[model samples]
Target: MKFKFVALVATAVAAQFVAPVASANDQLAQSICAYVADNNKNNLRKTLSDNRLRLKAVYDGISCDGLPLVRFAIKNNAADTAEFIIKQLPGSQVAQSGDIEWANSNGFAASPILEVIKARSAS
Candidate 1:
């Protein structure tokens, strides 16, 4: 009976640790969005590889006004998170556009992401 009780406790503890690891393709994007919103850059980076589809999901999933992931991070006041997201983008992804007019109209023009986007858009 004591052995059985110990096994049950061990299983419950393992379940707690295992719950956050979501690998299903269908749920990956949403999970990444949650991590980004929470400003958990380490988990966000782990959830999104350089894989095209994952990157696209990260691009599309984390947004409040059609903003890119980095913009969302900046808007949420997560500069460290924003930096981590910016490092993930490259090539065509670097040129990926967000809602500049929305940021401008919403008075996010001073945001770090907005500044970076404007600089890139300039030339």
Candidate 2:
């Protein structure tokens, strides 16, 4: 009985240790989402430095219908933050376009970024 108990405990410990931790990209996405929701530009800027916030994560998080985190910044006309993200993921046309449109439609004109998107689209 003691041996069986030890084996079970060992198995549980191994399973716990082997579980995959949240990737840095995932953490960054969550943080970005939070910052966007809070409309806290300063916190958003700081969160961008996390290595887990990769270009792919940024693109994935901000693209499609738009992630809630970045949606806040886009809606608020946070052009600088949006620009920074564009710079980070230059290849992300969908994210760039979505952000620019969200800003423009929401009364936060980001013409310069829009111009860039247009130029890229033209090419």
Candidate 3:
């Protein structure tokens, strides 16, 4: 009976430890999304660089095909950061599709960068 009790306690503790690690991906995703929404490009970029935050994990959580991080940059008016994300995802379908559309619609404007994305996508 004591052995069984110990085993159960251990199992419970192990589950507690593992559960948050698994859910961290989603938490990180939401954090990234919120950061973008809040327009914190420096923090967003820093989080992206942190392996624990996991860019792919965040991307997976948001269902974003394009670099959603870039959307955050664009929203924040951080043109340089947005340009970086665009360069990173060159030739991506998200770049070709609604990412640019959303950016333009949201107030990024149809400037040279937006035009380039549209042109490349058109080609």
Candidate 4:
């Protein structure tokens, strides 16, 4: 009975520790999404810097409204953010992610961001 009580207490303590971490991650994601949606490039950079995260490192892990970071920026008409993201990532990553094709098919062909994507992918 004593062991069971100890285990239950331990589990409760562990859960308390975990909940805050999950909430912190959610808060970070929300902040990042807000920055991208608002087209606030400088704030985005500062947020990432504050978290000690690089765009390239966290790009694959972050999604805003079910869209990848660059895609979310484009969907929100956040051109500066999109361009900044494309510049941060490698050309091959951009090409492989199908961003160029998606942009063309989704009526974003005329966006200057497409040109930037192409320019980045070519190099």
lDDT of 2 by residue, 77-98 (tens): 4556545555555454544446
Each candidate structure's TM-score, on Cα atoms with residue i matched to residue i, is 0.53, 0.49, 0.53, 0.93
TM value for model 1: 0.53
**Residue lDDT tens for model 3, 38-93:** 65667777878885554534453463224556565565655554554454454555
By lDDT rank, best first, the candidates go 4, 1, 3, 2
Error of 4 at 60 (Å): 1.2
**Candidate 1 C-alpha error for residue 17, in Å:** 26
Worst 10 residues of 4 by lDDT: 107-116
Q: How high is the CA lDDT of each candidate model?
A: 0.63, 0.56, 0.61, 0.89
Residue-by-residue lDDT tens digits, candidate 4, 1-123: 999999999999999999999999899999999999999999999999999998899899899999999888878889998999999998899989887778778987777778888899999
The residue-level lDDT of candidate 3 at 38 comes to 63
Q: What's the TM for model 3? A: 0.53
Question: Model 2 — which ten-residue stretch has the worst lDDT?
Answer: 61-70
lDDT of 1 by residue, 5-109 (tens): 999999999888677664454366667667767888877776665434455445655554455566666668666666566555553554545546666777777
* Model 3 misplacement above 4 A: 1-7, 22-58, 62-67, 111-113, 119-123
Candidate 4: residue 73 Cα off by (Å): 1.1
How would you order the candidates by TM-score, starting with the best?
Answer: 4, 1, 3, 2
Runs in model 4 lying further than 4 Å from the true structure = none
